[model samples]
Target: DLDEVINGALSVLALEARAKGLELRSEIDPKVCTGLCGDPGRLRQVLTNLLNNAVKFTEQGEVVLRILPQEETSSAVSLIDGISGSQAALRFEVKDTGIGLSEDARGRIFEAFNQADQSTTRRYGGTGLGLTISLQLVKMMHGKIGVESEPGKGSLFWFTARFEKHAAGKAALAKQKPLPLGRVLLADGNATDREILRAELTALGMRCTSAASGEEALQFLCGAIADEDPYALAMIDMQMPGMNGVELARTIKNDHLTKGTRV
Candidate 1:
């Protein structure tokens, strides 16, 4: 499944990201086809390579993976060779908040055995073959790959690939239940994780509000109760700065007005 492919890629580099105190998140467009006919192994490899590089270069902040369906048109279809009737074009992006690349560095980024500069090689050791291999794999899958970056502003690496939809999976997805509407409060110190969860919850037809700390969450909770629109659920991260998840849960439980809200 396409989900497996994306998750697998992330799993391989999860530890590395956590080691650097970085948040790893994904924002997959709901419209993108989930079950696709393609080489999952190669797809995972390409994704993992990009993510691994992103995590390695980023010391703090977050790394994000975004997937979206590309517009299908006559010209687009013609560009991707071997795209059959069942195939669809999709775009994958790996964005990072790390040391960005210069104009010269971006030009030869995908070249084998090369990096931004000699100092970069000394600072972060690598053969610089990852992007080169990713380029080859993307081409094999009838896709195009490129990068965009500005010095000190991080980078966004993207690629487009074509995959044929799985007939059975599409039918199963069509029969899934409709999403329920509800209000949700997300409390997390990590900006990236909060944003990711908010996007996902919003996509599921829930109204979401985010707070950076337990105190902030409590304020929102009480305000929501006063508005007569209390949140149906509060998703809290276990490890937070000011107050942890357990503390917040207890606070919510003790307050009679907010007690009714689920934690």
Candidate 2:
């Protein structure tokens, strides 16, 4: 689950973080268990909520999550503290260095119907359900939730849980070889989209040629037939002024010059 939660959270946060001019950093300790007995979907949801909170609240500064093995397990703690095996479990932590809280606000932070005060909500917008959901999720896994904050500083929220490893010595194999480049003809009246497509397609190791209009694409196809270069794909946007994408594709498909062509 190490790859699962982290990957999904990063993917979900990437777009939002970019829009805010912030960096989402992650450092997962090597010793942390990749195999854990837990609900992946719920874990992802918790991560998403926490990440979204960090991004939404912070105007500047970075948001980071560090995953590591718990130093003290319940069973180990029993031996160290001379307590019985009836001790509670352990879980992981999600901490952020943005928008800390005051002493009074900390007490009722994780309550189901409680959240940061109206001023905090006014400065930042949210339904206040994110932390509630996150707290409950940790509780469901037999864990405890806690937070540390300062009024002008930042906040560190953490939880702990115990999990059993179901699979042993399983490795995620990597696939070999890169995808082959596709030959593409990009046709669009909008120069920006056309250029963007051209750049993206070129980045994908593709051979892409652009046309300003449907007529331009048709002329390009006609020229390609004369000079003999094959096109594997044609992308034509339909809203162009004249000779739209469909017409361009039809012309290419029905042209006598391309009918018996081999390329």
Candidate 3:
């Protein structure tokens, strides 16, 4: 539901991006649970501002919006990080190959009615209220926004917001019709077992990738995490040649990157 809302928010400017010959795209992790408690309108406002800014500043290249569930130890550092047992942090990022910004502009980007320079407003045509409104919206969500840019290169604007995925959302997900679950990691030393599990998952509408050992599975998981599309589920044989199922599950649970996945 949240993802759908985000799509709607981005759609407001999609046509404009295309008209200017700019590519605008959004990606959400398959494992990101959709059921959440929050104001969709305010959430849209936050995303709208970021996307709006990304499109307005860029003359060429692409604008990408990425969403993923974040794992963190404290809400203080990133509110979208673990804020509570029943809640999870969802990170939103808007990256663009725009004109970029100066170090000084990055510092004051969130301030009300302030642009990187007076010339920015004259060239970009805005009152510089987008970031200011967005910052307040994020603050209301107990979240924070950040920016990284190098003049003439590109920029990455990111923020994190917490959401409570209630039991009802889980129930709804369980009731949803079968559909592809993005990527899955299959771990079993026995080639036969791995094939059988993979086939079953495939029939259930999933793309299963094989890992011969627990150590190998961890490597794949880590790589996938960096790519921001980690496995949604991991199937490991309880009895394997190396790094048995118990140990593998324990390792996955211990690591923040793969901890949220089903094992």
Candidate 4:
């Protein structure tokens, strides 16, 4: 399954991301097909290589994997081989808040045995064949791969591939248990983390309110209680600037008014 492939790739690099205190997140579009007939091994390999590089280079912030369905236009349909009928055109992007590449470095990024610079090779210690192999594999899958980066900002690596939708698997997924409906409050200092969580929760049929800090979360919770519409859940980030998640949870638990709000 496509979902399994994505989870497997992320799981392999979870420890590395945690070691650097980086949050690894994935945002898959609900419209995207979960069961696809394609080379899952190659897809997993490409994702793992890109995610590994993102984690290795990023010292702080987060790494995100986003998958979305691409519009199937005439050009898109013509690009994929053996696309006899309707196929799912998917775009996969790996974004990171790591040290990015310069214009010159981005040009030669996919070359075999090459890295951004000599310092990158010495510091990161890789043969630099990951991107090269990823490019080859993507090409074999009749996909296109590339990257976008700035010297100090970060990088976004993206690729597009086409896959035949598996009707049996799609039907099975459609019959899965429906997501619970409720209002959820999300507390996270990082804007990206908050947005990612919010989007995922909203897609699952939940009303979401995002707070940038613990203090802000409390205000929302208190207001919701006063309005006689307390949130059903509160998802707090453990690491924040002030108050933190634990402190906020403790305060919520102690306050009788907001105590009913699950955290």
Candidate 5:
């Protein structure tokens, strides 16, 4: 999933790379991850930040996004419980040929809103929040993000996010069991997403049901409560045909029967 997310994000950058006359290369290990139980969106964000930074700085040569599996260390294992299920650690690196950084610049680069130098913003036109956000997200997933750069030799920005390996293929996906969180109500206007979420949740042992819109979800929730079997989780879309997710959430919170349900 991580590799897929990275590839999807980078494919869009191919045009930008071509415009800049640099080769954007991806070398992902086939066995890097069989399954990952983290946010694919955030993973894409991290990759986007690193790759965009790489291309922004590099005037020539290639920008490579490489993934390799490794053994998780004691400290990392103790910190992120997610690593316990992982067979091998996943290491992602974005190596580029660019201006590089000084020792002092490298030290504070990961700090919130700080870049290599003040001149960088003037030249690059970013608010320097990308690395800060990436660092926070990587930490949340129980991973580490670092860099190795010299003044003239360019830089290598890397991060490690452990992946939980399971059996490969579609059968594996079908067999995936999510952690049970009781009855779950998936409310999405999109049929495809609703089906996918329902399948993933039901596979995890949750009693799953779907509604096409917020109104439908609310009506079902009310009916479930009247039947004395209330939903414990409501996964609603932000935008829908009827009342939106936020309004539905507010209504749920204010209602007596579903006040305590998690949304």
Candidate 6:
């Protein structure tokens, strides 16, 4: 169930990125598996916020989605790193090449409403509830969240959660229906989310792209149609710095550039 939920969260992010025309990549080790004694919906929500934040901030470059077997460490450090181990410890990481936070900001980044700076909040336009909510959920699920960033470079947000491998018979029997690869757009201020999403889309056999904001996503859509290759559908995030999802979708569906394109 947790794996399914994790796949769903990854799918959501991937679909969003494709809709925006951003490149996404993922490296989920097939050997790394886990089981969770947690609420799937809440877990998915927390994962969604972190992934969304990564995609929202990235203007260009790649985002990475990685799953490692490791335990949560501490908050005193600037970055979190770990090596492979015998006992299983599932870690979910979203790394992006976007506007990074200063050391001062990274300290309180997980706190509610606390971003890199006031200007970051204003320019990026997030409720700041994402990481806060994510932290709470991680703790509730017996996990930890950490952030590593360098100004003008990028950020890596990671969390560790417990998981156990599924048995072969049951694991083989359990399956999820394949998700269709439609035209999707992910609008965010982060690049990590975009890249991770892009990777997931490709894994699902869908074409994907990345955009930093709704404006960029619109521009991409317009350009796609201008190039005579439009999307079939779109999966957009409601929050963005410039134009919101509704406006962007309208611009694509109601305007000449993407009027023939699907939402």
* Error in Å for residue 125 of model 4: 3.5
Superposed Cα deviation of residue 228, candidate 1 (Å): 1.4
Q: Local distance difference test, per candidate? A: 0.86, 0.67, 0.81, 0.87, 0.78, 0.70
Q: What lDDT is reached at residue 66 by model 5? A: 76
Clashing pairs in 1: none
Model 1 alpha-carbon drift over 4 Å, by segment: 72-85
lDDT of 6 at 68: 64
- Highest TM-score: which candidate? 1
lDDT digits (tens) for residues 171-205 of candidate 4: 87577664899999999998977887888788788
- How does model 4 score by TM-score? 0.86
* Deviation in Å, model 3, residue 177 alpha carbon: 10
Reference-based TM-score, model 1: 0.88
Model 5 lDDT, residue 44, Cα:
90
What lDDT tens digits, residue by residue, belong to model 1 across residues 1-263? Answer: 98999999999999889989888988777767688989998899999999988998888888999988767433344555666657778889999998888899899999896767788878986537899999999999888888899988989999888888899767766766637999999999988788878877876788999999999999999998888898999999988888999999999999888889889
Deviation in angstroms for 153 in model 5? Answer: 1.1
Candidate 6 local distance difference test against the native: 0.70
Off by over 4 Å in 6: 34-37, 71-88, 168-263
lDDT tens string, model 6, 21-44? Answer: 656666664435444444678778
Better candidate number, 2 or 5, judged by TM-score: 5
Model 5 clashing residue pairs (backbone): 178-204
Deviation from native of the Cα of residue 221 in model 6, angstroms: 38
TM-score for each of the candidates: 0.88, 0.56, 0.64, 0.86, 0.57, 0.55
Q: For model 5, what is the error of residue 219's alpha carbon versus the real structure, in angstroms, after optimal superposition?
A: 75
Score residue 31 of candidate 2 by CA lDDT: 37
Candidate 5 regions with alpha-carbon error over 4 angstroms = 72-88, 169-263
Which clashing pairs does model 2 show?
90-160, 90-161, 91-159, 91-160, 91-161
CA deviation > 4 Å runs, candidate 4: 72-86, 176-181, 226-228
